[model samples]
Target: MNYTADSIDNLGISLRTFSKINLDTVFIYPTVANKPYQIALMHKAANNTYSVMDTYNGVTLNNHYIASVEKKDMNFFTATPDTNTNLGVTFRAFDSLVLNSVKIYPSQIGVPFQIDLKRNGTVVNSYTGLTDSTTQVVNLNFGVYPPDSNSIYNLVFASNPLINRDAYAANTSTIKYVPGVIRILNDTAQGKHNYFYDWKVAAYNYTEPVPVNFLIPRDTAADAYKIVFTDNPGAKRDLGTTTSLTVPDGLTINTSTDQGYYNYFYNWKVRTNYFKFYSPAEALTLFGDASKIYIDYPDTANSQNVMDYTYCSKMFTYLQTVRMRNTLKNNVAFRDNLVSTSNLAFTGALDAW
Candidate 1:
């Protein structure tokens, strides 16, 4: 499986397999020195058309001539454009996927240019930057677009100053095409040019399997949970007898769907306390009493000056009987006055003492 060329695209590898075997890593050895190469996997259909499966972009000749490739969700296909023409390519996503970026070969470096990702002749996302290299990858802000069928996309390129110059790399001899992934519709400038640019269109498969897990509170009595999609309200999934839930393809967690828990406390508050005290009551009783107190106090505070008036009143009532066993052993009337005055009398007594 040795491919020696200045540039390669759509290189095929035939594998005859009878039993299921796992492919962990792919090793690619590039004889050329100091060159970067992209290795990708494409699946051939029964109709003899090919679609991108997975692509590895980190392959280069710098890693001791051996590039260990791993399967990623990214898929891309490249085409060579005409260097003499300032044209663009119109294509369509054969499957539902996120259009990640488009890498183009620019003729002039450091020149300002704009690349637009248009859907059905309308610009949806645009990338503007100074050309820095021969291969400039333009990234889009929108993660996904057209989200459905019947929508076509165009990758239009334009340079500043409006000069008739060589802006992109194109191929006139062979027009690269990947069905059900990316199919060339037409040329933006010339109709039916039968040529495509040296543009690398990369995308992530929307239906690609992504592993997901959900964690539920241990104290919650909800034996069943339901996950609802925000984008599609009608779509829902029920978690039965398991805390782990299944995430379907094309649905993003938190972004596209919202997880719901039934029979659980909706309004809950959290408080952190560093001081631990041993109580004679049961754990459940202590927990219940602690839940009612929203404000926490350190073990020692000088004169209760920092306490809020309302919270201080609540704390004084809760600790009134306990304080009676200490310095206020015989001061029942004083404790009552402290509570009635909203702990102001207690503050005055502490200041006087």
Candidate 2:
């Protein structure tokens, strides 16, 4: 499934007539007919505007331009013409499951490159020849031990030959709380990293049913939760209630579709019990007020007994019991208003009143 795909926007080929030459982009095309380590000449569209051309294609490639898009064994890249130098991720993992590999969605096709998997700012491993020609699911394509505890693991792309990445580019508003999954994106500059993007990873090896709890916080400024896995969920993905999930207004979609694309690319799918959707006490503040937090009322007839927040510390339907607790409990002294003398004892229950 090796390909050299042309961009959809034509990479600045003036949809109308007489437009500026697009020299800022290195259009993706197969290395077929073009020699390896080749330095194709630039195509001068106008007086001083020029774009590179594929060597075999000669000059004037349909009134467009081209530049250096090579198959170099890129151990590192200074900066793309788009200036996307660095991209990393800090996300959660299921404690009970061992990590299989990570899944990354490229904005464009990056045929030959290396991905450095970083845990807490340190390089764990580098996956080479990781190509995503069809703009579908990309993986680390390796196995590693799960985190020592349920914590946030970071990802540093180390190499970003792709641009125009797909993320929730709709409104800068709306921060969603995603449960049982690990996904967080930042619009601001994360350290010296040039950019940020939304990506996902998978975990495996669950001895018993463990809720995949990832305490991911929402970004108050930009759209906190970019997108976990919008379209084309990873192949052989976990069986969770993902179909019923709600999506943001505008989620970026990759149009480079090929029947044989995902089949050629190895998308790492980690085997786990199920994804957990529990929000921690700290994240509950994202809603702006703790008192306004909603809780599911199990008793329809006794809505008055409901608490501000209820947590299922442990739940096992097969075990026929669920352990839950209220985060808020209050006690008050109540005296019988009736003047009639009657010996009474207060059990200190709200319902008894």
Candidate 3:
């Protein structure tokens, strides 16, 4: 809640009250973190001498006593700290960082907060929710797209963006707050009006539907091989491997045994199946039958519908003529003849030497 010059204090407050006091170089610290801070409102006098206000609380000192006032040899001031702006942390971008979950620490739980994912300065995704009163850690999660693998990214936390941010000042009030920040606090383990802190993130590298080819080891034994994959679509496989593995048959593809190698290093998650087979014909028949059972690919680059390049009729979109890319030598004879440097004989005589 944004606080205006209201009769009572609220969470979202805007402090725009500028004073003509001679207080400069003022130092402040919170008796406790995320709470009201005591400010040593100071003044200057003869020969530019400095005088400190003798109170920890924000006290309006008399103009006459402003100079010779007894300095309070105590710690801090009793003024609320008002930060009315969006605050958050930034992280360096890596290849395919698919961040879908976010966590933050708000000093005052239960208040609403906005969390956004900024990729190259553009907000590609966001999640907003009220902080749960029971827990200090606020969580916001949703399905999100993978931001550009090469661009910089930042996570921004702010008050409810839906709320309009026009801060009002009440009559006869000098102390104020800035708008944009949403803060709340209680007496126990709290400083001035509480603000948010300690932001944490969990993300993973982006993964796409991969094109994989298994070249069965060409052996004279005509042995059988088993290949298994865990279907982990739309999950952060970049944080090492999230896929479980199993060696189906004693005859294993030595490479596929390690989950990390296939999940993180190789980027393959076989969640749904394993192929145990022998001979190209058997594999082809099984694949054909499996395609009917599971209608996975219709018409995409990753589809199993590979055009038979051996025949001209199957290559519809790509027509193969006698002339290939290398045979695209239009007017090659004429072009080459010009380069040979031939001169016409008796076509013209030298007019001047």
Query: What C-alpha lDDT values do all the predictions have?
Result: 0.37, 0.30, 0.29
Off by over 4 Å in 3: 1-86, 93-110, 132-135, 142-144, 160-353
Candidate 1 global CA lDDT score:
0.37
TM-scores for candidates 1 onward, in order: 0.30, 0.29, 0.25
Worst window of 10 by summed lDDT in candidate 1:
65-74
Of the candidates shown, which would achieve the greatest TM-score relative to the real structure? 1
lDDT of 2 by residue, 217-335 (tens): 22222212211111111112121221112112211112222332211111111111221111334225433344432232233222233331345323333112221211111122323
- Tens-digit lDDT string for candidate 3 (95-206): 3223323323333546676666665678777666876642244444432333433445555555532221112222232211112111111111222222223222233212
Greater-TM-score candidate between 1 and 3: 1
Task: Candidate 2: give the clashing pairs.
Answer: 4-29, 4-30, 43-51, 51-66, 52-66, 52-67, 179-277, 180-276
Model 3 lowest lDDT segment of ten: 65-74
Top candidate (lDDT): 1
lDDT of 2 at 296: 28
